[model samples]
Target chain A: MKVKVRVVPDGRHLEVEAGVKALDLLKLAGMNSESGVVLVNGRPVTEDYRIREGDEVTVVRVLSGG
Target chain B: MAKCSICGGPAVAYIRYQRRYLCDRHFVEYVESKIRRAISRYKMIRQGYRVLVPVSGGKDSATVLTALSKLSREFGFEVVALHIDLGIGDYSVKSKEASIKAANKLGVPLIVVSVKEITGYTIPELARKARRPVCSVCGLVKRYIINLVAVELGADAVALGHNADDLAVYSMKSFITQDLSNISKLGPKTESIKGLAVGRIRPLYEVYEKESYLYALLTETPFLHEECPNVDFSSMENRLKVHINSLEEEKPGVKITMLRNMAKRIRDYPKPQLPISRCRHCGLLSSGDECSFCRLTKRITGQPLGPRAREVVRSLVASLQLAPRQDSAYKS
Candidate 1:
């Protein structure tokens, strides 16, 4: 039960337990410093979104400046 | 598992209002097509016109630039960019570099303008000297500099990165303050004012914050992840943002609904015409005796703009006036 996660642009990827949340995966990959929208399989999900086996996740920043 | 409404692929994002899940590729197409529709629906872009997009090396602006660049190929319009260096040490340097990288990636020409060089005072210096908040001063400087740059470049329109969240916050604040006069100003494209040579466009007006960020990431657009050192997250906007996020969590697509209503109200508002007067100091059109920027600079500098400064500003205004009146189509 391993899930594949990749952070775009950074091209960083990792495998984590299927039960892990998106935030947990990001933290494990050392890419959790900034705030971003986590996408699982092709849809945006909350950080608490559970990662199913074979799920592909991407973390993208969502903040805007004036 | 949810399926993409269009492709029947693995859906990555769920659009509550549309009541459908979108796969990564379909989501990208959805966002880009939405941008295209918003632009044409609002007449944000015109044929044979140059648009000035201010890039701050942030995800939102970068996404706007990338989208516009992609559209420019088929639309037959030019997209140029302006990046302001406020001289805030590493923040400014890194932000400028990111803007340069994004502009280069998009293959668009970018002009980097320095506040200290043009105004004789860096943002930090002016913030320390002015009684107003640092964010206010920074906003003033950025608007003034970008507007001047747009005019100098003969741009027909100035595009900002404000998205659905930003407009929603603006509406919330305006509602609380009971200031309805500004409501008409919130929309996809603003009418060209008498004084300014160019109108303004919010191409990302309907796009959500998360969607824009994801667009930037998936497109590999270079942008800064750092916030301004002087920014106050406790400000009214930030507070409203938190509140809005909570509400959005409870009911997705609330922001979009609010923005839609706001836009409709604006469209129904009666147009108000006012006489415009030139600011004596800068020779720019002003509703007051002196423009807000001039007054702010004077208050901070503690003196009239010297002859040289006056001449510089006057020349800039003169050049702006000489630019072609390309935004006449949108004029109210």
Candidate 2:
């Protein structure tokens, strides 16, 4: 069930297990902040993105700015 | 070490097909390569003066710091690192850390200033109150704080990490505004008013942002790289830069040279008309009854900010700037 996962933040690459929620991938990527959004190919996705094989996930550290 | 072409000193870097040599202690030749000019080309440093550099822990500032540090030794000026912590979540924290690391690498004294300490409010609080854009508020606050602190430190000039990209934006805006005097004030060097104390300079004015980024990667500073979520990169300013940058391949130095020339022309021409008076409220330099910053600060402070806020909405509607929703005009 290992799927190719390129986590953002530290950009640590991982072979996370399949069906892993996006939030888990975020934590696995070594990111710990109040809020960091994620995107798959330029579209914002919630923490529940189902892990498929070969996903280019981009984690964005959202600054609570005006 | 490559021997100096003239003095037979050791040289490690090459420039413009010139086999230059500079000794370890007498390093003017090496400094010139980093600064892209001979020592005489720029008024980089004066006798026994100290410079405060506003570093963002980004590649641009890192390159500026390195270049200035090397050049300062030859030019005989003291260099100090200045960082403004915007409290932009992790970005600010990482930036401050990188700045500290850069300061350590360069062996210069560093001063840290934060909104929380100076202004009694963090960036989030300010942004929340005004509903103004984050970048605008943060940028103005940072610049104001740096200048004020630099002056307080008795620094001759405040150096910034602004690169060619930022300069190009200013040039374009100046051209659009047709404000010649404003352009004149924005050369490679800008001095504050006589009583203002600290001037502003961009020693890395000729350096490109991409080059800075690459240098950071090569230098291996522990930096957290992330763009501010607030700025919509698709905005007009960014889009124009990208478009003009794309055309740079067709004609080399098209955008830069043009901007450089425009800057020179403005420098050579008449000064822009100064705004009437300083704002009554905060008393920073201002062009109107209430500066744009003060107005924004009021809203950010959770005040009604009534009449001016309405004017903002009317102006937005009139200029077709931001959207003009009826009830939303006074929400701020």
Identify the leading candidate in terms of DockQ: 1
Which number leads on lDDT?
A: 1
Off by over 4 Å in 2: A1-66, B1-42, B177-181, B268-270, B275-332
lDDT (tens digit, per residue) of candidate 2 on B150-186: 5445567777776666676666766677865666766
For model 1, how does the per-residue alpha-carbon lDDT over B139-183 read when each residue is reduced to its tens digit?
977877776666556677899999888888887787688766666
Candidate 1 docking band: incorrect
True contacts kept of each: 0.24, 0.00
Q: What is the DockQ of candidate 1?
A: 0.22
Evaluated at residue B220, the lDDT of candidate 2 is: 54
